[model samples]
Target: MFAVAADDCAPSDPTLTVQAYTVNPQTERVKMYWQKANGEAWGTLHALLADINSQGQVQMAMNGGIYDESYAPLGLYIENGQQKVALNLASGEGNFFIRPGGVFYVAGDKVGIVRLDAFKTSKEIQFAVQSGPLLMENGVINPRIHPNVASRKIRNGVGINKHDQRRCLLIHTGYDEERRVFAEPAGDKFL
Candidate 1:
């Protein structure tokens, strides 16, 4: 991933360094995996790449959002239209437990970011991963996200363009020295 766009916010303003990776599932095979199809953890990206045959170069690879303390995906996970881990709705501490946690999914020729309850009846999903405290929903920022909050955690998030609603936008930001998950506003059009 690279800086697809830089913000126009002045130098004196609160800052964040951001990079975005855009995925078009139509021409790309976007799938989630924690292990091999045979049900063995591939252990490393290199080993997984070696085991599975793919066409063309891998454009991007990223942490599949917040996982459990053991590093397992903490919520719903779907790969290639197959349900792997069921959606988690339990409440507790940490980012994953944040109320209104949602999922980023790819289904048929579509991509979406959906809230927990709304995701229940979704069908034909090709790929999906759940993560907490949605950055934005219906163009409104999550009420819990305070740009001035003391949390200085650099976090990554997935979203779909509102206007076009086609591509999946993967964003990773520069570290927040405080080391906890938080959010910041990216520009209207990230170039």
Candidate 2:
């Protein structure tokens, strides 16, 4: 796998802070979680990290998918090759229902982003999470998204490395733990 130079990823807007980590399915242990084995929901990232750390697995964690009132994933959620929740294709308010929403998945040592209509189940898929508006695919941004739209909030997405198909970047923007705004919403361009 190849690593892109940091200069290539420098955000256009200096004020919009982006934190990213490179993940390769073959070298790193990537898993999705929403609850404990005891049937209690891990309602927040802090709670999930604490639980994992208590078991001596102190590692980075993030919550980028949408969840409902009970914290259950609103779309497809899989764990260790088992589907926990089926894909969601219903009409709804907000970003989840945007046309051509997609799934981010890990299959064996590879990762992929595919439009919901194009998603398929396979034995090779180790983990998957459905979320979107399928921002961009194959170097093209989804046409449904406005280029200069003012609507913004804390958001995150996975991007495949152009240099290495197996490598993916977990990207996030907006406020930090202390509630400081990193990516201002009013900017003309993306952070």
lDDT: which candidate is best?
2
| Highest-TM-score candidate | 2
Candidate 2 residue lDDT tens string, 68-168: 89988899987789998999999988878887888888787788888889999999997889886766655555677765554557667667766777777
Alpha carbon RMSD to native, model 1: 6.5
Error of 2 at 176 (Å): 9.8
lDDT of 1 by residue, 60-178 (tens): 54565566555577788887777778998898987777777888887876777888988864567877888877776666667766555555566667777655677667765566532
TM-score of each: 0.74, 0.78
- In every candidate, how many clashes are there? 1, 0
**What is the TM-score (0 to 1) of candidate 2?**
0.78
Clashing pairs in 1: 153-180
Q: For candidate 2, which ten residues in a row score worst on lDDT?
A: 177-186
Cα miss at 186, model 1 (Å)? 4.0
